[model samples]
Target: MSVNTFNHRWASVILEALTRHGVRHICIAPGSRSTPLTLAAAANAKFICHTHFDERGLGHLALGLAKGSGERVAVIVTSGTAAANLYPAVIESGLTGERLIMLTADRPQEMIDCGANQAITQPGLFASHVTQSLNLPRPTPAIEARWLVSAVDNAVALQLQGTVHINCPFAEPLYGEWDNEEQAWSEALGDWWQESQPWLQQPQSRFSESQRDWNQWSQKRGVVVCGRLSAAEGQQVAQWAAILGWPLIADAQSQTGQPLAYADLWLGNPKAQAILQRSELVIQFGSHLTSKRLLQWQNACRPQEYWLIEDRPGRLDPAQHRGRRIATAVGEWLRQHPALPGKPWAQLLTELSSAAHTCIEQRLANEFGEAQVASRMSALLPPHGQLFLGNSLVVRLVDAFAQLPIGYPVFANRGASGIDGLISTAAGVERATCKPTLILLGDLSALYDLNSLALLRQSSAPVVILVVNNNGGQIFSLLPTPIAERERFYCMPQQVDFSHAAAMFGLHYRQPQDWASLYQQVTQAWQHGGVTLVELKVAETAGAEALRQLVQQVGAL
Candidate 1:
């Protein structure tokens, strides 16, 4: 077979292995260097291929798809800065364990270290950000094809823990006639060539059950807190907490029916903290809790037994507390341990949390602002939709105040939480779930990902890009920075609007002046079935200031 044929065959084998490994989605950024992987993906009927102009946006798109579908998603990008642009998403995958298979095309070894253009070091580009890295040399008859398939299978094996970078360095003459004649030369393919399975099967990741007497732990007053999880995991864990009669503090990402949903705010109350702090055992169901106050309390109180249960194996504790870190699926763990109920603990926190939610309702009554829009999430959204929260003030608003609509899936770039590619990620979530999507973001975040609005235009389901036009990074105002450097350096206010951006993208645009009008606009947009940009122009400090006041009042409870 010709060299070009070998390259295509090599790329095809990798794609096929990824397919057998349960990757149904592949996000590709348009580039010449990545043509082999892109064409291989296009030729296959097993994958739904998505193409984007930006590698950064493409990585986030794959991330959202993987997080929504609970499967590994593939990404194909060219070498040089295109691969470098994926660093943010790579870091996020590392932190959150959303599996990404990045197939980056690079120049052959001959082109490197010789002042070659577009040949900056491709190996170890992602470094520690990815879980595994495979730098494949140019396809040659000297190297058996079976090694390529096995390499892919081993790297992608039953693992959903972060990205696996596969760098393909191809020589010139990349595009040419493809032939399977090379397959005949390999006696090594074994039965793999004829079968539709992976070259190898990987070991299942099992939880090392320190299975210490659960009977002893179950008797103690326990608190179950959940972070980012699949919709089903959230519902099941919520049921477990309910049956056990333990107080459940879940992040908005879980979208579980929370009892003390406003605990992020009400946890500020000394009375509430004192009641929860008396717990003999504090059992957290997941990692990456959004509530700083709750995490701080745990760090200070340091309960006799503070056990954390997460599917990902890592030291995920933000406080770095010495606790039992169990690695297992939430479902598997729930099934193994039956709920042994005792008198409910921290019941008083419910009343204080209710007060905080009530405070939010009263303040946002018949008004439209950043806080108002965020506080209305439970009502503004229906269960048939999903949420993609931006990294700035809006996410914190939802985390602190909003009680989610149960069973509605929520997506966010909480890992390496940067205000970039959010629009593309939300669009990917819409495509994956085939449900209405609501993207709540600050004006600055919208500005950062402004180009990604083009992605929304291609959505198959309804999408609402709710831009809280606070005109700057209002999240900065929450900090106690000196007044001299606050506005110009931190807030970096931008006097711009999204109406033209919506118009540019051929999307429906609405700037609501009141709360009722905003509600109608968003709900109606979903009903109309397309992308809509709803801009809420508010004061620079409204969201942060309101949140501070809400916490203060809730503390008085």
Candidate 2:
């Protein structure tokens, strides 16, 4: 019953509350200030502790775990820049509505802003990005133990909406032995410690659209746009689209199998674009579409009515096109207002998409280019497996070329959409799912998150990291940047390869030169069940040229 030091006792109670509240994973970055929390986590048998040396990667690792497991994950870090390193992941969690619990160890009020070592103004650090931030007073016998438990409970509850930050301040003597009197303090907890339940339970409120609101646009000529949806939610959106006879423009991240395939291509084609503009209404289920062409279409069409259905409370409609914002889940809203069978309004668009898909197939066939590699990977993805797309050109390539296997869940750091944490995020996904996880990233993204390659060693599942090495940010070549300045400002060329990187990380490395070789390597890596880096080397300008050619062919069609 003697839990020893005040810091240990406080850490114990906080961790207990988190575990009882169903937080299964705790990511820790070692630091003197965070010794108490780290030791407490180590002591707790119910929690799975993951250690990361880099706080930034550690933060995104937690983000990926939360995303992959669909549960709240906690991250513990020391004060000063250690806490600051988690800012990017915190921002990502806020935008994606992922639950992350940040337990930052800090110095007490006296040390903060007083030139004390490893101390800074830690409170309100994440500010508005976090759903809730609480600065706990320094551990002391005077502070009520129940109050600490209650604070954790509240933070866990708030995390259902987004990330929660709990900053703990501790004075020196962070670690110490137990005393006889401390035994009584432990026993005082009584049934609170014995019961494997949270000290407090808070119910989450569900959002539902009013029937009147639903009825207003139920009969209009519309299209369902699915963006960044879960596989289950994507299925629901697809069902709604089918029943309502609306064309479903699904983003690669949507995980919807029945979407208008090659819709991006169709939207890019002037002739096909005209056909898609027939819709009088636009109903978007999620946000952050990977295609700029789709956004442009929405802006140009300026539909009479635009209704966005999403669970998160954010302005997803960046184009200001949403006439009505239904802050509710797509499935919940659909359930509230059952879809009545209607005439097919998007038959023309669907047919055009089919033609566009055929055109893309022809363009990618027999070509060992970036688009072909993406297409092959998408086709080879195992059923029910997970795909984590990096930012830059890779996600767009997959969005355009890949024919996703049915029910395969696609993940991306699209909220912030930065290339810093893709590898670490994918590692977290692999850790959580323990399934065949494939990562498609470009050379720039791979280099940006190069340090995260260390995380692959910890993954229990097979992770096939397909890095399309175009030598640099080849995406810039496709832009309107002048040719003379492209390499300096936009391309930022890197002449490095991943063969040595793979060896350094102890992964199976292969650089496939042809389509068949790449496909074979991917399949073997995925089937063999270990970490592998399949680098597909393409010319720096090949990707941009392929895209241009594809658009031209689609336009011709």
Candidate 3:
């Protein structure tokens, strides 16, 4: 009688299918069932594997990678609670329309009834939060190979809408050696092309709307406010803005080119009072927007018509009806809106924009603190690298003064704005693509997810994190909470040195006390290195004043 031996052939097939689909990086949390997948991924020279102790951070890392690369990235973890750890990033991805693929490894269906260790009803765990969910069985080489390809294709497709999940169930014999790696890869690749029907072509539709002529609805005082968008998307929006003779008001994540008739798109929050009041029409696209003033304008001015162009409309603020949702792509809407003759609106908006930018530039020039650190770092970021701006003070300061050097891809979590797993997501971005990834975060955001730095050990792209350590949660001061109570609960300031944390995780770390030194160090770390941290200590009160001053200047404009 011949004895049947178990092998990791199934995992190799699954990993190969993902690699074939252009998934270059995978963030993994250690577990028995996930071992085969991780090992196979690690062995594949084309694929990078990032290891994280926390599954939550792993999920965010994958999201960050997806945002940076503009390609869907996956997260691998054990079943049961391990799969649940991906919830935070899943929610963020769903709300912001981020393309993140989550791969949770689980025990076979039979094991679920027996109460197996780390086993639960994994199906539908993230169904509500994700665009779609799928599960595949670990079968023999021939069957599993086909399933692997199908799973990868489905994951990529679902990512177009938002987040997607693929749960893999391994029966037994968890680990072994694969005798034929080529056979596994060929089978999966072949099956995917042959059997899996591609849904690549989403037929473009002509935009139909009531107001074909934007001039009919509003005159020379028009404003273009862009949210988070890809480079291609930004260009499309910019072209549209040019045709309409509207001045652009862009967020750092908006991707809209600078000097859009307006000297700076991000003049400290697009929703600021001054900008919104000056504009008669406000057309918004993508997401990553956190402007209280915009919401206030929507309620107060109640413009004749506030048009929202989105692939999926009626999602942005349910309470307000000041804007009617136009179910069409921004590019399509812009193409249909008749071109404007003069640059009157553009000129007025530009003057205001230039004044605001001048004030911000002056403040940044005078200060060598955390507030200036963000703007300074923004000035230094590579023109084409991916930037993952962490939430809290970092994002606000970036919003105030940081202008994305032209041609860079910028991303952030503005849907729910939580500092839980930013670094993890950014690390995921670094691991998944060959491009340079920069994470500009405050000390609070860094401390919130310290486990993310540990995931850097397996990344292929160079990741440079600028940690603006203001000692505590400086953003808390701007809020309405009581100082002492807020300091303890909301701020929760901890004096954790990122240097020691990085060393503990076997990563690189640096402390730059001045602007020149920080700039030189950051430039070196970002240009050539694995994963490095540049920590800067600044005064919280002064940083807050700088941010407030930026806001005031934008309001004055």
Candidate 4:
């Protein structure tokens, strides 16, 4: 392949590398500068290209893909303000530590400052949020392929670690004849003449001396708090936990199964504070957690030794580690650590889990009316299906009423814990896995991503959205700072009917007003074909009191 030929095949090379590296989806937002990249991506059959008119939706869509597939996904857009539209998703992905790749098409140096329409300095634009940022060189047979391979490989490493940004800058004449494209790239390479950096094998990182102490400390009353784990990694961690007798406390985003299914002592739930107060060591992995109570508890206790593991160098502990980042596999650390001589932690945790299970069952069967709505819905969900829980009261209810289902991979946006992109992300998951995706969302979250209904038309998977409609953001009522005068600001309730919305999207809709109706509706939704929405209405005041009681029971454990 000659230098001229490189320009002709640059996108092909990049596409090939991405596909080979396991990029399953490419989300593209329409723009002029990005036409070449979009066209090339669309031409490739291996990659699934999803088009979104809105750049923000595109970013969220990519995020959803990554979340569903547990693989890195890329979002492509043109330069300038178009690229800026991705900031919200980028920030969310960064906070959640989601693996999203941002490919921005930019004007080269000359056109960048010449007052071009869509030109801007895209380099280092999202460097703060993303794991890596790169500016690609002029396409050349010799260098173009090399850069693509390098960019993707580095991007994957970062993506596996979290979110990343890569800027693809091209010279003038963004699009023209294929021959012209080749000729322009050839000339640019000739002008360069200098050699490019050769790629090298990434060095294998191992646990450091401090890491040895960290591992030892982690074994002493250490609780494994995982935000998200890939399917394979999740199983490995589970086995390691069994061997080490460690308690695995996971949030829905963890993509891993909690060790004890009905364990109320899991981290991030209301009970986690009581469990953590007795802990001497804490091993933090993945991104920031959601529960403000858990965050405050960790801050208050400031556990004796906190160890956080990350592939990339940075703050591992949300409590600001005070210790250095350990660049070793968590499994590796668990493998090296000596097994505990006694089973005090295991025995206590098992008792708590048993008691928690008993409490949940008693509450559901014998407790006050209205509490059964949440409990029944929680129980009706498939034990092994992917659960996309919405933020706010819905998530807390799942935490309160439901036991963590074994072998079920759960997910939520605990980083920011906002409800803006739930449906979009859920749509992405539906498209990616084609699995029966059950989204436990609140009315507000359902309303926020109503546009996601448009995207749902494109999904192949049958999604069952269980919208807990308490008329508004019921989570606000549970907060200590009640908005007496400012209730409207926090509890913005809308009287939007989901049945009408579902009809607009050509989806199945059902409004279950009672426990039996809700159960039957959920059974049909989960088993039926196409997308389905099952809405449940609960009283906010009664629901909050029940939740408070549930937390009290958790503390009792």
Worst 10 residues of 1 by lDDT: 184-193
lDDT of 3 by residue, 252-284 (tens): 777775543123232333444455566766677
lDDT of each: 0.83, 0.83, 0.69, 0.66
lDDT of candidate model 1 versus the reference: 0.83
lDDT of 3: 0.69
Predicted candidate 1 versus true structure: per-residue lDDT over 1-557, tens digit per residue: 57777677778888988988889999999888788888989999999988888888888888888877878999999989999998888888898888999999999888889988888898898888888889998888788777888898998884559999999988767787777667654546767756777888887757666466887888888888788887888888888888888888888887677767877788889898788777777777766667667667767766777777888888777766666888888888888887886778777988887778789888777556888777778777745787888887888888887888666788888888888888878877887888888888888888877887887778888888888898888888888888899989999988997899999989999999988788889879878888889999987887899889888888887
Candidate 1 Cα errors over 4 Å, as ranges: 179-194, 207-210
- Please state the error at residue 37 of candidate 4 in Å: 0.9
Best by TM-score, which number? 1
TM-score for model 1?
A: 0.96
lDDT (tens digit, per residue) of candidate 4 on 183-271: 44434434222333213234334544434554456457766666555555566666655666667665445545555643322333444
- Residue 55 lDDT (model 2): 95
Better of 1 and 3 by TM-score: 1
Candidate 4 lowest-lDDT run of ten: 191-200
- My TM-score estimates for the predictions, one after another, are 0.96, 0.95, 0.81, 0.81
Q: Which stretches of candidate 2 lie over 4 Å from their true place?
A: 1-4, 213-216
- For model 1 the local lDDT of residue 200 reads 83
